[model samples]
Target: MALVAVLILTLLSLGIALSGTLTRLLLVVVPYAVFTLFLAGVVYRILKWARAPVPFRIPTTCGQEKSLAWIKTSPLESPPCLWGVIGRMALEVLLFRSLFRNTRLDMGQNRPVYPSAKWLWFFGLTFHWSLLIIVLRHLRFFIEPIGPCITALSSLDGFFEIGVPTLYLSDAAMLAGITFLFLRRLIVPQVRYISLFTDYFSLLLILGVVTTGLIMRHFFPADLLQVKNLALGWVTFSPFVPQGVGTLFTMHLCFVFTLLVFFPMSKLMHAGGVFLSPTRNLANDSRIRRHVNPWNAPVKVHTYEEYEDEFRAQMKTAGIPVEKE
Candidate 1:
């Protein structure tokens, strides 16, 4: 149903673009609406999270902590300072360091056991890096006189010189990575059981967007200047509809806009949430110092000695160690 919805919506967008009835409406009104929703939604979500009290220094620790001068600590896993935290965040966001260490559980006879699940991480990294490259490569479409660095990047990306149109390695990598990710979700029993329709829908939507984009670039090329003008107009707050851009390009742009508009409201917000997460950002320093939650109310704690004192006679009769016995 989600896939069908995506197909229908994409086809509908294509129809609207082809109708030639309200080119200015989609070019101006739609971009403004989508941009506003994207901005407002993201700010609202981030603010909500910022206002929520964490109340504890529960940094997500996965390795040896900083303790006893003689023992070494995994700084990336349990950062004790800002520098370490920065490094940790870098690896986490860019390389998916934690996911790279992910393990899978499987039933062996009557027992359950964990096994390597690094393939998921591999594909995830590939997908993200390729997607980033692709987005960067797209700067050429939005900028006039395209910066030297972007031109260099474009040259490097299509260095293989695969064809007349010049195929990009990032494009192939992105598609392959997407395919691998989609298959992994289905092939892994645990992942498959935990996956929701939203997961499938997101994957399908991205794939559709990528496919349509590739089709536009290769099979049905459009006026690069016109597309760039449209993009620049949107950015400058003076959107204008450009002629010669195919309906397929419009549908692809719509899907990309949809993803951006829906991003903050969805689980995809985890990209930002991960940074704010106390568990992943806090230091494991409980052994060296106290971490008292300011919100915690004072309470009387019962001591072990008090319990022993109360049951001294009983403890002695039962042959248990009693201080008073």
Candidate 2:
């Protein structure tokens, strides 16, 4: 199903590009209009979620929180204060810090689900960092004359200078990581059943984006200058739709736009929602004071006198304490 969907999308996009019926003006107009809707939807959803009331301080704790004066606390794991929470969030966003400590267990014969899995942390780290680098490097496309920062990143990324077209570490790492993640889903029975169309679709979309991009660059080379010109014009609002840009590029661009449009509506909103989540952002000070839900409803209560009135004889016979005889 996932493959069929992608193929259908690819064919449709190629047809659109080849039609020549959709004018340059319309193609240029459509992407930006879609981008606007995408941006608006993202902002609206985020704001709506942010307004939800979290009545209780319910930050998730994995390690020792601030308790006794003598006991040391794991500030990063179980943040007890605001600063600690910020630090934890930073690490999580930038480095996928918590995932570094991830562990997996497997069931064994005559024993509990009691054994090991390989180093998922390393692969996860490699993939994320490489993706970040790739995103940063692409900054050159949307900017005029390309900033020195981008130049520096390009230099550092291809510092090895191995061949005619210098090798990028990110290209290899991204492929390896995507392959592992996909395999992990297919090979693991539990994950395979639980996986939905969206999960598979998202993976395929990203893989297609990366594969098509690589092919465009290393194999069937497109004019980088023209590509950059088109990107910059789009970014600057003085849009220019260039000719001779291949169908593959259009399909890739459409997928990118599709991902962006789908992002806020899907689980990908976790990127922003993470910041607003009480589970990650709140201080864990449960030991320091009490927290009561302000929105809790009033409940009927029976006083001691009423209790005594109801069971006075029984209480006296049983020799139980009574406020009044």
Q: Candidate 2, residues 1-325: lDDT per residue as tens digits?
A: 8778888877777777677655364448877977897899889988997899999988988899898889998998898888999999998888777776665656568665733344566777777788788899988888877889989988988888866577687887888887777777788898899988887777777777788877777777777787888888888888877876776677677677777777767776777888988898899988887988889899799988998999999999999988887
Instruction: Give model 2's TM-score versus the native structure.
Output: 0.85
Please report, in order, the local distance difference test score of every candidate based on alpha carbons. 0.83, 0.80
RMSD in order of candidates: 6.0, 4.3
Candidate 1 to truth, TM: 0.87
- Each candidate structure's TM-score, on Cα atoms with residue i matched to residue i, is 0.87, 0.85
* Model 2 poorest ten-residue lDDT run: 111-120
223-245, model 1: which lDDT tens digit per residue? Answer: 77788888998777777778768
